[model samples]
Target: MDYIDSICNASASILDMTPAVRKPEEGKVVLDYILDNCAKWPNKIFLTQPMGGDEVLNVTFSEFLSESKKMAAYIESLNLPAPSQIAIMSKNCVWWLMADLAIMMSGHCAVPIYPTLTAETVKYTLEHSESKLLFVGKLDTHPWNEMKKGIPAGMSCVSFPICPSDVSYDKWADLIGDNEEIKEIKKRTPEEMATIIYTSGSTGVPKGVMLSFKNLTDTTFGLINTTHATENDRYLSYLPISHGMERWVGECLPFITGLHVFYAESLTTFVQDLNRCQPTLFLSVPRLWTKFQLGVFKKMPPEKLQKLLKIPFISYLVKKKLLKALGLNHVRYAGSGSAPLPPDLLAWYRSLGLELLEGYGMTENFNYSHMSKPGGGRVGYVGEPSEGVEQRIAADGEIQVKSPGMMMGYFKNEEATKETMTEDGWLRTGDKGELDDAGRLKITGRTKEIFKTSKGKYVAPAPIENQYISNIRIELACVGGRGHQAANAILMLSEDAKKEAAESGGKDAIEKELEELIKTVNSGLDDHEKLQFVAVVNDVWEPENGFLTPTNKIKRARIEEEYNPLMEEWYNSKKKVIWHKW
Candidate 1:
């Protein structure tokens, strides 16, 4: 069977599971939930952030409300016009959420910028959003000297307590009064602007996506109902809160559900934080999941683990022990999104007793489009449309969606906004997808990323690339061949793989293993889709290197552009794979 047919067959069993239709809470906003929770669960731990050496800072529901009110009062004191724009550039932290809540409380729109963004983009976002005030917090990787130049001259700025920058700014502590009492909360209507989140464009300039209070609240409620999450659940906030997925789920979801959230201090403390939080709900991207698998293999080789899993009683104990060691034994709902996950990887996780639910959504939709249900083992598909979400595949294979959570539009870009949505009002997702026989959506590739080969046959790279990276050794694999006879790939070895290669036969051993991996992957593809040659690059893709988005998604177009010059020479080489010497 072909690709579409195979997906349908795989999803046949779960097709009968209908999605739950939950009505959004229209009368209440996210802020209302926070205020109500404060009254109901005043002493409950609302947010947690780790410091060094077994020390952690916990904020109770009451304290969160009080602090946010004080911050809002300070913001109101600024005397900025109603609905003024305020920009926040920070990593995920308690202050980020407090500032966001404060912005809404003061009747202003919050604009979030990824903390890792460059000075040029930062300046462009600040100017384009027309933000009157800025909250600078936890800018670890940002070039402060160069970035401060981008801040509009004399623009009022407040520095978080933990901010390491020497840039001149008013301290958040001095701005707030001793008394937490503030003016009565300003009630915002459902249609009132809440935030303008700029897209972390993997290609080209980032555009501000305008979202209303209604959009975010509706999406949060939908997710809570669909996932069956409750106040007892715990969440870890580590992903960049500037990204829409983290903003909605990691930040907004906690307010609605009253779930306790723990913040990772840094990458070094990620494991310790996870163990301390023991989060009931966890969301991670595909790359991290692969890393987790690699971590497991490091302790016990994959071959050994597979053989051990085949044993009857020992397999159960092994799986339990392995999960606990990874600090995921308590994770009831594990989700993967922001990129497509390979089917093999999903199955591998399932065997270890962690059902990695694949979700499908984008920044434009408040990251609430489709998600796999618990106990529903639909491996390759992203499950059915979410509650109150309508989806259809366009004639050209793009997935179109209409939902209450959909963004208002691209902020201040009318022409681009018009082009993004259909005349009939469906938002164009720009992703090529197909609905399986079970009505589950399976994303095939990106519309703009598909390339036509010299043989006049079009090839979608994502699916092939996903297959290629299924091997744990292959960290990143970018597939492309716009005018070539066959598709080619640029492969980067995983960190562990690189170390293993260096220890064991060096480049020759790495090349041999990669050649075998390519042969194995190509055997599963059709002639036109098979990778003719792969250039093994030593450099790893990273956000700082302009190869990955802040959310850790590969920048496909950027990778292709960077490696275009080396492609022809690699393709002309006699060997099936060429090791690129960078």
Candidate 2:
């Protein structure tokens, strides 16, 4: 009658890794095994990404270990106390994880910070957590500069690869100063803190969730069992490494499964990088995947593409091949998380021969909760409580969980931590959802984001936003109906579609097209749930503005505040982009 039993014994024909049932008792606790094994498989093309033309930065297993050790030695020389916080900020790349491993190896806790965080949020987090050290990749500047202004005096700092900056950096060769027989200090307990991951900052000021080595290790095993990830698989670490989803899959699981990981340079070029890498398993948040899907549609004008695909023969053959060729071909295992993935998007991705799986987890859970089971076609449900994970639906329908991956507690916030979990110890996931007939988890919506209109209709902004975006334009949409007369959407235009519209028509025409697009998107929703108004964002939301979180989800609260006053005019008027002159 329990959740796991219900899932394992459910009515579905899913792939079972039964004969090779993974036993945690048999898994290694140390991170050394993964690093060492990759060295042994040195010639197997561990990690790679292409540059402008024929130029690629490739790392062999042996090179990875050497660089990590050098960075680790540099980490030791900092002489910070054990459990000192080492924060990482940047886009996903090989060095990002390298610094993360170095922090762990040197006995410091890694705190992942978003590159897109606003100056104010960065100030609050750095000072609140009292993190002494930070490693920023060369990609982002504002967060680093803003964070620099906020830190207290004498806080030690480091940067990836050694850029010339005020903060000290690892010189690689000069880092040998720690030697004269450097002793490797190992924390024997799995409960020893490994990282303090702050919340995605979607709703409010981020809460620092302190996770231990056992939490990371156990979650890695749980993910391995659920996804059947192996040493031979390749992963593209294009997602922001700051988010929990990225930390678990892009960082922890690689240690557990020994998968090779390559980083894409920037968000603008992620798809191109994805094609160059041909990753075996790619993990990303829903926003990016939906953008990729939109890009595919834009390449062939949607009406033309949609009609051609409607023909059974072409749909069966040509359309499938086109999607696969666009770097999506080898993504055997694709996982979506950070924010809930729209079920409609999942079904559409599948239509292109892509296996889209939804994963549920938060920083508080060390990013392990429920993952759709392999071979199980549970479209809307986050499959089952992953191996070694326990899930329960609380009285109010919030999904609560107990797992080895649970954090030690919120950093220096005992009262807040206590409030998050039950007295008996289950971490409460703030989002609300229900358990289906098959015992699978279906996330209905966020409890807080739901708004009730004067007419007595309760509308959850997420589901409404998903309906607008799952198969439509707008990179990300946030709904705000509470306290307002009606609901509206703040949208970021699709990059590819924007470009196509520009080439075919002028900017004014492109803007006009978006208005029509909004009409079509709105037609699918109800009078109450449908957006009462829409705003087309000319510029995309970036991390610098704090309008977007690191995982690329919109910072809804910030957007609402910025646009709060305009609602009157927009709601009173009719078309999209109320601020921009039509």
Candidate topping lDDT: 1
How well does each candidate superpose onto the true structure, as a TM-score? Answer: 0.94, 0.86
lDDT of 2 at 188: 36
Give the Cα-based TM-score of candidate 1 against the true structure.
0.94
* Model 1 per-residue lDDT tens digits across residues 1-582: 001000111132433454465555657888888878889999999999776688888999888888888999998888999999999987788888889888888889999988776678889999999999999988774445556667878889998876765745898877875956468788988888899989888878998999999998998888877665668988888888898888888877898889999998887777888898898888887788899999899899989999999998999999999989888888777877677788889889888877777778888888878877766548778888878899999999999999877889998899989999999999998898999887788888888889999999999988888987888888788889999888998888888877776774777777787788889988988888888888888787887567988787788878988999877777788578787763
Residue ranges of candidate 1 with Cα displaced over 4 Å: 1-24, 142-149, 165-167, 177-180
How many angstroms is residue 102 displaced in model 1 relative to the true structure, after the best TM-score fit?
0.6
Per model, how many backbone clashes are there? 0, 1
Q: lDDT values of the candidates? A: 0.82, 0.68
User: In candidate 2, how many Å is residue 579 off?
Assistant: 5.4
Per-residue accuracy of model 2 over 418-523 as CA lDDT, tens digit each: 8899988898887788887777888888777778866678787876777657646467777776666667777766666556545745566656765776688678
Model 1, residue 427: distance off in Å is 1.1
